[model samples]
Target: MKLLFLNWIFLITVCYSEKDGKHLEVRERLKTALLQDYDKTLIPLMNSRQPVVVELGLSTMSMDLQGDGLLNMTNGNILQWKDARLRWNPEVYSNITSIRIPASKIWIPDIQVYNAVNYGENSFSDSLRNPDRHLAIVTSDGKVLLYTTHKLQIRCDVAKTVPGPGEVFIDRGQLDWPWGKYECEISMGSWTYSSSQIDLKPYLNRNYIEYLDQNNSPYLFTEDSFKDENVITCTRFKCCADLYQMARFKFKVEKRGTVTAQGLKLMKKDDKMLLISPFLLFTLVIISIIGTLFTISKLCHRKPNFLVE
Candidate 1:
């Protein structure tokens, strides 16, 4: 009896040990599978170095009287100057070429010259009056791009004249009003510098400022020489207005980081079952131990011989 009891205990110990080993193997397998899935989904983003195509939209207008004379002196006529230019820095990005962007991808602003004096003036009157005016995109040494070479036509408005004593006019009235709008698209291919990598996290929610420089001069937009210095800020994939004077603009980066985050989320979700219910696992272990013990007892105990008459 003593020997039988000892054998039963030994058998139960062996069986429980084997069950624990199997559980550990299963846990390891699950961990490996999770890692494999993560690699398949997110590893490409970390290793990829391909060039990306970026679309840039620019729109701006300027209305400055060319000469020193007031609009009223010109009898409701004035020489208004409207100009816009696009530029970039070559050191940060390369291979900046103009691509033919489709109309659907371009945001065409309402190019209109408004005048309070003329209530029913034709909208296309300015374009027709100035047949030479046009928008052009010029590429320079693969560094800068210029858009809207021709000047815009704008009409001025003059205030009503009021007669005073001695035939003197109280107010000559206001001269031509300044108003114009410009919208255009430029496409460029870009990649990160070989020595540096771009971190898109900070720029995701905020605008990135690009300083401008003249194509012929080294002076930056902030300098006094570049009086028309305008800064362009890129929000996401779109940049509008005053982009010409900026030295460099930021391009929208792929959302690979977001993809990686999503992958991690999925991994956690898939492993949740294993991580959440420790109590259930404990119950399984207990049941396994009980099963092993019962098997061992049955094998070790000999059935009592039935003395049949």
Candidate 2:
């Protein structure tokens, strides 16, 4: 019993030491030291020639399509990049591994949704403009992450994607409406800088994409979920060499509360079977009744053949 008790005490100490939170004083000191000489206007690269490697990924919340070739996508953007200016030694501040500061005090990539339609309630440009509205998490090794939600309204040529059930489209004019799959592209990149300035990259994995511990993260929308059915795909593209470092996210959105053509056909066939089954049963019953009546009439007339006893 004594040995078991000692073992439990040791385990408690080890667990507590692994994930300890720091004090406010420790975080404040580190923040002041880092931001004192930080320049928010300039890129955080040590060498001017070296490109700032920015990692970007999205967690799609929901997708909705409109009748006018528009696709509304609600997504969460995870943007992270190393800042040479935000580095600090955790030993100086109570073994603090990370700190949070107002986003206004740091430099962030001027990312913009290139294919945005700029429609109502979609202020993509201003989403990242006001830095004071968000907080930046800076690790001891100078990694900065800005995790926030973004609403995107993109223009998709739905005519190309409008081939419905039993549809053989040879021309765009034959495309139908309100009942087909729609494909849309959300292209994001630095608005003011070229590819040489900001080198764009995708999230390292689900961990960085969630910007939290994968196992314990509350935000359930994940990259693995999208990969299951080709719902979302992220690719890096450029118009030419040295152009803007853009990443295009292409995904398909189905019509609201609708099923596939094969499914619709299956339902129709099922309905027809349902409608015809009772009639078939009734016909069989009527034929049986008529045959019984004919048998009785023959018996009544053939009585003289047997005997008149």
Candidate 3:
């Protein structure tokens, strides 16, 4: 009976290994078939003129920097769309419903942060367009998902956007400084594709806004939401009768105690010295008066010593 049990275990392990080998073979074949004639530069659409509908979602991995009319955020962009060219019959491939592939292997939408700071053609900008940032999951039905995390440099108009007490608006862009609340609205879309090439939609509104290091964050998201048709690229830009599909996110950021601590540490040495100027001047005046008095007292008490000298 013991010998029979050992044999049974061996048979089961062999079966699993055999099944795994079959799966690996299927994956390799699928990859080759999909890419053998695939065009990575063109849009994966059945017709050339039809716009590809791309569902978009975003969440903040970290609040990297916010000041001087600029906001930098490490954000996760959830992009999903269907590509008829990538579809396959799962039955032939061991019924595998999904497979993972590097994003560089396929043609993806040319999405851009339209309002990004330094939105120019440079090395940093080129890096943003690099497909290395994402690893996509392709489904047997031709649906592809690419979740990409990027450090977005966006234009911030916190001074004008903040609401509430009038005095809060009086302080320059930084009145809130290490304190107060500010509004940051970010717009994203294909800068070159236009609405004709792509139909952009915000798929998950508030779902992806989780802060990775909440404890160390200098600002808190006071108001965050994925708005209804009310806000998803809802605000249109009319140019030459062509509409640009857009995704815009509005975040209300308030200062945390950590910001104040950092604000002091970041203060310039010159600025700190200037802060104590009045006190330093007062101390110098007191010392000067004491020294003058001591000198007078010595002269009054040492007339004989002066004559000997």
Which numbered prediction scores highest in lDDT against the true structure?
Answer: 3
Q: How well is each residue in 180-222 modelled by candidate 1, as lDDT tens digits?
A: 1111111211122211112111112222223221222211111
| Shift of residue 28 alpha carbon in model 1, Å | 56
Worst 10 residues of 3 by lDDT: 265-274
Q: How big is the positional error of residue 90 in model 3, measured in Å on the Cα after superposition?
A: 1.2
Off by over 4 Å in 2: 1-22, 119-122, 161-175, 205-242, 256-262, 265-309
Candidate 3 lands at a TM-score of 0.68
Candidate ordering by lDDT (highest first): 3, 2, 1
* TM-score ranking from best candidate downward: 3, 2, 1
lDDT of 3 at 179: 57
lDDT of 2 at 24: 60
